[model samples]
Target: MISALNRLVDLVEDHLVEEVDVDGLAKALGTTEYHLRRMFSSLAGMPLSEYVRRRRMTLAAADVVRGGDDLLGIAVRHGYGSAEAFGRAFRAVHGAGPGDVRRDGGPLLAQPRLRFRLTVEGSTPMRTRLVDRPAFRLVGHAARVPLVHRGVNPHIQRHIAGLPPEEHVRLKALGDAEPAGLLQVCDDVDPDAREGSELTYLHGVAVSGDTPTPGDLDAIEAPEGTWAVFRTDGPYPDALQSTWAATATEWFPSNPWRLRPGPSVVAVLDRADDFGTATCELWLPVEPA
Candidate 1:
């Protein structure tokens, strides 16, 4: 994975003036574009598209300063058709227009090339299992919520709170599958997994496909697939969120599987009255790498 990501970085640098085909590059590296973009965003601390733009602008600023060509020509060479389009991109990255930078030679934000490396550590282990689940319905009060990477997501909390208390009881009773409780489900997530992206957040439960859903409740039809389940016990949401991050950082890199598009389900095994601490089982859909 590290080698592939480094090669991808090299490819980006080699084709800064050209339209790099990410899907083809990912295919050449023996990975999917979805996984590649997701991993790049996770490790690079920015979206792949954003990195590409910044890298292009970083180099374009040099030509603007050197005075070899006009702003329109430089912008067109960098894949922008017009000076207006290129100026917007240039100002976004360098905080100054190309014309101003051409005269003043000031204000440049450079995004350095990315490199990925691995460090072997045998200190901790991840608890995981492979589950082949049949098709099940996720039934509950659903909401559109922005994605949050760490700590608690207050939007999810408020969404669940807005549901009638009895609805929670009803959802729990409906669950008869592997994740046997009121499940916290996130579906139709953006492949890049960008923070603040809106995702289908279902405070729901898994049920058999034949199970009937109430018209008032939102439902997500989850198809049968292989799942990677991780179990954790600690402070509510904090430990769970850490485990989630570790899957991309530690677990997936070392494993022979890659994430697939599906609803991520979290089943609460136990929790305190105030929801400060608990045990949780996180189910993520995946396939052979």
Candidate 2:
């Protein structure tokens, strides 16, 4: 996985001003583009697209300072059709317009080339199980919420809080599948898992495929797939969030499974009344790497 990511970085550098064939490269590397993008974002702390933009602007700054090319030429050379488009991208990355930076020879934000390395740390073991599940439907209230990498997402909190207490009981009554209780379902997540990106958040319950969904509820169709379920318990969300991160950093890197495109579900098995601590089962869709 580390080697594949390094190759990806090389590919980006080799095609800074051109289109990057991530799908092609991922196929050649025997991994799906989805998994590649997810892993890259998880470890790099930025989306691959964001990295490309920063790198492009980093190099463009040199040209802007050198004054060897006109703004239009520089823009064209960096894959933008016009100066305006390039300026927007440039300002987004470097926090200064190309024209201003060129005149003052000033502030430039550079995205350093990335390299992946492995560390030998296996002091703690991950508790996981592999399950082959059949198709099911998640039904309940759904909302589009921004992705938050850590802590409780207030948007989700508000969504749940706004629901009538009876709604929770009603949703739990609809459960008839492995994730048994009311589940926290996150779907249509960005493969890159960019923070603040909008994703479909379903506060729902899972039911067998044949189970009839309530007309009043939103439903998400989940196809049959292999799942890697991890069990976590500790302080509120800190432990759960850490386990999620470790799946990318520790588990996937060592295991033969890779994440596939599907909704990630969190089942709270046990919890304190105040929600200060809890045990959770994190269900992630996966396939053999």
Candidate 3:
């Protein structure tokens, strides 16, 4: 994975003036674009697309400062068709317009090329189970919410709170499959997992695919797949969130499994009345790498 990401970085640099085909590159490297983008964002601290833009503007800044060509010529050379569009991108990346930089030879924000490397450390073993789940459907009240990596997501809390108390009980009764209780489900998530990205949040439960859903509820069709389930128990959200980050930073790097595209499910086996702590099972869809 480290080597693959480095090659992706190199590819970006090689084609700063043209569109880079990330899908083809990922396929050739024996990985899906979704997984590759997710891994890149996780380890590189930015989305692959964002990184490319920053690099492009970083290089374009040189030409702007050198005054070797007109703004239009420089813009076209860097794959932008017009000075207006290029200037917007430049300011987005460097906080200054190309024309301003050209006149002042001013400050520039440079995004250095990224390199991923592995360090040997396996001090603690991850508690996990591999399961082959048949097709299922998640049904519940769903909302579009922003991705939050730390602490409790107040939006999620609000979504749940808005549901009538009887609705929670009704949803629980409707569940009839593994993850056999009300579940916290996030689907259609951006592979980059960018903070503030919108995702489908289903405060719901799992049922066999053939099960009929209530007309009033939102439903997500989950195809059959292999799942890697990680179990954790500690402070509410903190421990669960850490385990999620660790899967990218520690578990996936060391294991033969790679994440596949699917909705991630969180099942709370136990918790406090105040929700200050929890015992959670996080289910991530995966396949052998």
Top lDDT model:
2
Off by over 4 Å in 3: none
Query: lDDT per residue, candidate 3, 1-289, as tens digits?
Result: 8778888989999998888888999889888888888988888778888998999998899999999799999999999999999999999998989888988897799888777889876577789999999999999999999999898999999999999999999999999999878899999999888899999999999999889999999998888999999999999899999889888888887888888999999999999998899999999999888
In terms of TM-score, which candidate is stronger, 1 or 3?
A: 3
**lDDT to native, each model:** 0.87, 0.94, 0.91
lDDT of each residue in 55-154, candidate 2, tens digit only = 9999999999999789999999889998999999999988999999989988888888899999987689999999999999999999999999999999
Off by over 4 Å in 1: none
lDDT of model 2, residue 254: 93
Report per-prediction Cα RMSD to one decimal: 1.7, 1.1, 1.4
Poorest 10 consecutive residues by lDDT, candidate 2: 104-113
| Minimal lDDT window, size 10, model 1 | 115-124
Query: What local lDDT does model 3 show for residue 67?
Result: 97
Instruction: Give Cα distance to truth, residue 35, candidate 3, Å.
Output: 0.8
For candidate 3, the per-residue lDDT at 204 reads 95
Flag the better candidate by lDDT, 1 or 3.
3
| TM-scores, each model vs. reference | 0.93, 0.97, 0.96
**Selected candidate, larger TM-score, 2 vs 3:** 2
For model 3, the local distance difference test gives 0.91
